[model samples]
Target chain A: MKVQSVAVLWQIWSRKSFVTSSTLRAFSTSLINPSNSILMSPSLVSLDCPDTWTSGSVQSDRSSVQKYTSKHVAQILDGKVMAEEIRSGIALEVKRMKESIGQVPGLAVILVGQQRDSLTYVRNKKIGSEEVGIKFLMTMLPDNCTENEVCKALQSYSENPSVHGIILQLPLPRHLDEGKILGLLTLDKDVDGFHPVNIGNLAMLGREPLFIPCTPKGCIELLLRSGIDIKGKKAVVIGRSNIVGLPMSLLLQRHHATVTIIHAYTKNPDKVAHEADILITAAGVPNLVCRNWLKPGAIVVDVGTTPVEDPECEHGYRLIGDVCFEEASKVASAVTPVPGGVGPMTVAMLLHNTLESAKRAFKFS
Target chain B: MKVQSVAVLWQIWSRKSFVTSSTLRAFSTSLINPSNSILMSPSLVSLDCPDTWTSGSVQSDRSSVQKYTSKHVAQILDGKVMAEEIRSGIALEVKRMKESIGQVPGLAVILVGQQRDSLTYVRNKKIGSEEVGIKFLMTMLPDNCTENEVCKALQSYSENPSVHGIILQLPLPRHLDEGKILGLLTLDKDVDGFHPVNIGNLAMLGREPLFIPCTPKGCIELLLRSGIDIKGKKAVVIGRSNIVGLPMSLLLQRHHATVTIIHAYTKNPDKVAHEADILITAAGVPNLVCRNWLKPGAIVVDVGTTPVEDPECEHGYRLIGDVCFEEASKVASAVTPVPGGVGPMTVAMLLHNTLESAKRAFKFS
Candidate 1:
């Protein structure tokens, strides 16, 4: 019976091999020291468990035993569904505003170069605007556009009475200074929330930013709509990019979570990630999170959408998130999928911010 | 002998009452759950002791065992000493600039009201500037001064070719909009780093601010001078105010530390503080940090300088830091004392920022 119990224990314990190694080392050390009889109490805990360990059913039990085992499959957050709901709500608001004020919200997107990714993003934004009844305007400049040329275009957008929001698609050109060109856009018209004043306000307490960065804002919306409570939860954000990780952490902190950001320079990231009740990864590294890296039943939002070669797919590439989906889905309580998750939410948030700007500009309730 | 060991364990454990309660709950639960043998190992860790527990000699032996017990007295992170060293360095650089460029740095201070603390701070900054050979200029306005008056004073200073930096003493008359008035100052002349653009830069990655907030910058300087490694460490800042807590948290995050801020709404601040390798308190609550509120051997910086009733002193009230100093000294690895720690450093950082502004304005190396 003892031998059979040990084998059962090994099977259950092997799943938590990464975290339990230190505990096992302490247990082994206690065996060598007679004075460590009190320490033996922990090892005896395994002896009391029945051999009825099953990896398939977690709903039947909500005890620590179930928590320790990686048998639970996460419920999908479904950002796509939430975003569609928000877009519909925004469309209703737009309709009401246009009826009252006889003017629709307008957004201007400035694209400098022929970068395929930037062009695609701009097109998606335009489509989102059209769906929401927002007037979409675009300013396309050559690859060799000067800083002055970019600044001139932004100033025109800022001065235009019809344009309620202006966004400069990032990575303008190698020769032009991005900061200087962005600074030319008036604060009220900076819909992307990249303006320093907006970012500074976001960092300050008792202050409100004109707009939160769309991607991070979307992550927060996903958590909120899915009923994931952020207050006092241990949240680990992987990546420190300004657009995603930095602002995501700030938003989480504002929501009163104990937030930690793990960047490329971070040591022992897996250990940190495993300790979090909520884990958000924007590291752009494909499949960085496996089952072991997550706390059992943690809430996860994977922001990374990297294109990896896959002959099995028709496009010759498939989108993979920072999290290993198949394995992580078994451990996390709720997880946001890569393609259908944060991408649509970002576009939705952008439209939301533009609508807000128009309302404020037009003096509507 | 077993009873004696238990008693001794109780005494040591009681010192960490807040933290050990969770541990004890986990231990007692293991006793109830016969299946949790692995959880039992942690409870037994208290049994293997050699009866040589003493709280006094922690300064002598800096080991892991010492870290587990709240016996070690913290080394003083003396900000006075560091500030003196920095001021001397700044003075030497000022002398070199005078000899090379035949021009010395100048600073302008704008005081809107006659608040006692603000007056004292402005006076100390003047003294520090004079001691460092920088030209000092001041413009004092009455409590009833109009917003235009403040803006006019700021504009004059901004246009002055000799003035390198401008600072507005905080707590401007309650009626005036502080943010709007401050925004009127040109970015280059804004040395206080409270300008939205400067703060925005501080919040963003890959961007550097023209000046960092003085108090937060001083905290970083103290930590750096004390040889405290920030990278990969768990840091907790107890406050969310714009000037101190918010910027301090941002600065720590920039240094690559896993950071958490415990604001008014945080549910388990004590547990959060106990887990931090580095803790900074700027909440302005006197004696908010108790001995049990720290991880043994943790580094602490108290930014709160609240005036509390002290009838024994010549003055009826005395300045007390947010931390309960006597108790915290016994638990922390290093701690900054109230009056001498962050105060002098704030003044020193002001002078340093002014020098940097002058260097940048003059295009000097």
Candidate 2:
């Protein structure tokens, strides 16, 4: 058997002091226990081969000639590459729709505050929409904007004939009522899928929601595209946030996966997590999931993207996932990396939802 | 330690063949492992003492002089008694409101198709309402009634000032669109809490629903009244029907329990069920949950009520719970029985929700 040794180092930065520490880890590509490889299906292996042991290390020179053998190394579920492929396919469909009917999908966003992360998210969404040939529009409001102002903006987008999908960027000012504001968005144009009706439909059996929340949808897409069978699988989702964790569990259950949700108040979380065949962590706590939290040969999807300040990085901060990537590779059969994994897929799913809304509105199938 | 042995025989009747086989089992009242008693809080023990080893056997003579002893005998979570206490409280409040304000809470039901089970449920609701001083009204329609007739009935109740709450009996005729008809119900009058908006609110965090579904609410009431702590507990809910299981799981999560939902496609369900500190079975399959499926000292809430035909019974049938009561009594710390357990609690909760709706309508604090 041909063995490949990959040495990777991750710099852990403390949130308070900005102090960093690095640790080196290596795993082999060889399958140590063939019987333990539950997700090593032919279709998964084909997509897994290209980015199998790619490291998210900031320094490229960390890879060395030293050979370190381990039982198994996880196949990387590369959302960046998958997202690009989906975007390209969507772009072609958008072009064809434009040529045939002279109409393109339009997505409008209501950005409440000028939070740095929210701005970056809105920019990425705009770029992703443009990449797919979808028209993008935004209504910018100040942090001190009243509820009426936000409602007016939502009403405008809702009534606009060209606008197919509308989203209100979250984490509004403390003065504003988030639930009341979100409830005002028209159900037809709610591409973000935060509306109560959409959530209810998603949770219920024999009912379909107009849209599924983007981040969870992206995670499921990554799994399906990689040919992982969700039916009859034991799935554990950490965190129960409405945006990601709650909908993610509901979606997994819809796919016939027995799902357990672990929240902050949950006791013995690791014990619960270790029983999962498929584990999705969106707790937003850096390095919350360790090697012991995962079952051997379990597929892991990390949705957490906590920002830690790092002086060595160009962006002044590094994105850390809930799972310890260096540790997870040795235990998990497959894992998704932060920054390049669920993040890119969330943007891609948003574009997909927007396109779907437009198609539904136009009765274009 | 003083130990008490109780021999109980349950006649298991198969649905296809009503051939009954009686099995005699016995359990001790003594605490076998003191350290394993997680729910042995003082408040819980008090409620556990009364009706601790009561049996639901149809034959009274089966409680014989068999001295077979086991680790424990589960405390009966008597919903019938608890529901009566709640109804008395509601009755007092209703009497006060009627005397002082010259108004009383009114609940209207639209019953389409005289399905035997539905008719029995509706009749029980009416009797329960009258007992609690709540005005009850019903609209009867034929089995082949049109959707428009149902819609008209719903509209009349929705517009009526006297009717504070309206419930359209579930399992409507085959031809009528359930979702569409449910959508027509006024949000304020959705006392049954089947509306998508209410369900969505229940599923979401930091949002309150107008009404919670009766059965699940009743189950939680049972736990709380028994002084069982739900927070930080491992809960497993079997079956995911929109009515009982889904909302039950969601409600458990709201109380901060680490919840796992097991549906038909779930693999190794007993393994998952064995880990729960709180196990609620709503699978509707008689005796689906066995002794091995439960964790030691786990509180079992059996929501299943599958009616089995019997020639000896007064009603020509007997209701069987999801858990095998004889087996569960030996392993579980506490368990709810069918027919007299969650059944009466459902009616109590329905009246509670109706009174609340009236209170909100009248702006009475």
Candidate achieving the largest DockQ: 2
TM-score of each: 0.77, 0.82
In candidate 2, what are the lDDT values of residues B201-263, reduced to their tens digit?
888877778888878888898898888998778899987878888888988888778899977
* Each candidate: chain B TM-score: 0.80, 0.81
Q: Pick the candidate with the highest lDDT.
A: 2
Q: For model 2, which pairs clash?
A: none
**Which stretches in model 2 have alpha-carbon errors above 4 Å?**
A1-71, B1-71
Best-fitting candidate, scored by TM-score? 2
What is candidate 2's CAPRI-style docking category based on DockQ?
acceptable
* Residues B1-365, model 1: lDDT tens digits: 00001111112112232323434544454457664321111111122222121122111212342443445578999876566656656676677789999988999999987875566567667777877799999999999999999999999999998999998877788888887887798898777787777787887766777788877888888898788887668789887767777888877777767777776655456767887889998877678788778888889998877765679854355676778889888888899987778777777777888998898888975
Q: Give per-residue lDDT, candidate 1, residue B262.
A: 71
Per-prediction share of native contacts kept = 0.38, 0.50
In candidate 1, stretches whose alpha carbon ends up further than 4 angstroms from where it belongs are: A1-71, A97-102, A141-149, A172-175, A311-314, B1-73, B98-103, B144-148, B311-316
